[model samples]
Target: MNQIVTFGEVIMRLSPERNKKFIQSNRLEFYFGGTEVNVGISIANFGGEVKHISCISDDFVGDTAISYLRKFGVDTSSTVRSKLPLGIYFLEVGAVMRPNSISYNRSHSSFSEIKPEMVDWNASLKNCKWFHWTGITPALCEGGYHTLKEGLVLAKKKGIEVSADPTYRSGLWKYGADPKETLSDLLNYSTIFIGGVNEMNEVLGSDYGDSNEDFIEAGKLLLKKFPSIKKIFDKIRTPINASWHKIRSRMWNGDEFRETTDFDITHIVDRIGTGDAYAAGLIYGLLNFDDFKAMEFGAAASALKHTYEGDVNFSSVNEVMNILEGNTSGRFNR
Candidate 1:
């Protein structure tokens, strides 16, 4: 396999120690993460060659973030430095009936200041087989949108596969871009759609329910509108509470629809990057397995992420394969 390239901001996450609210803790622990980088790191853990592109502050904080990605085997050579500060978010981990909360302070951060000239996409995308992007990048700044669009257009020309995760957050779209229009336009360049009914409805302005039938219809309509999309994969989560959840994945590959069994996660350690884990697993599986098996791999990877702490899923390929093989006993491996 060639390189997998991810484009997005690297955010600094500050959280109060284990299950404690901000008010209850005197100090905060920090970790580096973002949706795209999280996926990159997870793929790297699975032994994929991944290159991450982004702008970080020209300071120690940015240095630490680069070191963090390097520690996870992600290539950060394309990551650039800016005089702006690094983006930061505060997360409040929840338990049982409680819920996690987040506050962002990233508007003026280094990533938001990214320009198209900052990254030489032609060189960064060299030897790249797959490119991954999320809607959060475009929502940040106009420059981000243009930069990603430049890469997408080139990726299409180069015959590279593109995965689009349109994680539309209304709050993040404060930069004056039409969320629906922006996402719809980007979808034209994407080869795989990585979202569910809600994202579909948001981008298409359709009122689709959560039933399987509704999902199938929405997916078909999506492919009809965006002819470039070859398949659709969605990760469905049934959250019982902050501590436990059930996850499954479904897919529509042009002619057939496939779904996976639920992987129940009890006593969740962290829920931050479960979706990223699913995306990473899907990418890896698609590169090596059939569509149905890839969807199952994605669901299992998502279930495994809840067992680990922080924003990146550090679970190896064997760990994810164990879940696929029905070895969820959390047994000690000596």
Candidate 2:
């Protein structure tokens, strides 16, 4: 198996219990997840050799977090335990008419305060075939951004493939750095860029509108700027209500543009970590199948994730492959 390494923050996701709104709930349900780490867990569930790198408080809470990663078969040897606090986010699940909302309380998190010395990138990535990260890391804090940047540079030096989810989180980018500049610099070392057309304007300084043609043009502009990018990964999402979503995925692999079949995802169990699941599935497909098949697998994998209750997709390879083969009825096996 190809060893994969994902570096970023892992948070305690506190959502209102029993699908209650934030104001109506008295108790919150907690789950462990983060963008890059979620990707690691999803890949691990599919029998991949993956490692999650993050910083957590040096206490029982941090140890528990590491334990969960280990339970999912994700190697935690590179995780750092520090004296800082753990990052957290409050999620409010949405209903038929209303939309979902999130409030972040991750300021001063151990991962946010991660220093360059805390991560031994060379040792951690020595045998890594793929190194992964997200734009959310750079948006967190200067220290986190630098730490990720150093790792990415080292990955390039070691000839390891690099991938990123250029996710645009306006709420998290409250730091001093400009997202456009930060993403441009970090994406220079990336081989695969995962995000939508809107990110082009939000983080890449492009002036394209929402049309499919505009998206394609904007993608071309992006490829021109970042010569290292060999593939562009993205998906289309349609709102059927707060609880239902219609999704489809697409990719451009330098010479070819491909799209997957539309997937109608109804009755979402948990609204978080869909992007990470998609990214993980795409990476798996890219490594094991053709470019177009990879897109289809990624889309199907993420659609199945909506039925799960947590941030990580525990769906197996057989499950995802079955969905790709038009077995999405969720029927029982005899």
Cα RMSD (Å) per model? 0.8, 1.3
lDDT of each: 0.93, 0.86
Q: Which stretches of candidate 2 lie over 4 Å from their true place?
A: none
Candidate 2 lDDT at 118 equals 90
Q: Write the per-residue lDDT of candidate 1 for residues 1-334, one digit (tens) a residue.
A: 3999999999999999999999999999999999999999999999999999999999999999999999988999988999999999999998999899999999999998899999898899988999999988999999999999999999999999999999978999887889999999899999999999999999889999998899999999999999999999999999898899999999887688888889988889999999999999999999999898899988999999888889999989888898899998878999
Worst 10 residues of 2 by lDDT: 251-260
What lDDT score goes with residue 152 in model 2? 91
Over the full model, what C-alpha lDDT does candidate 1 score relative to the true structure? 0.93
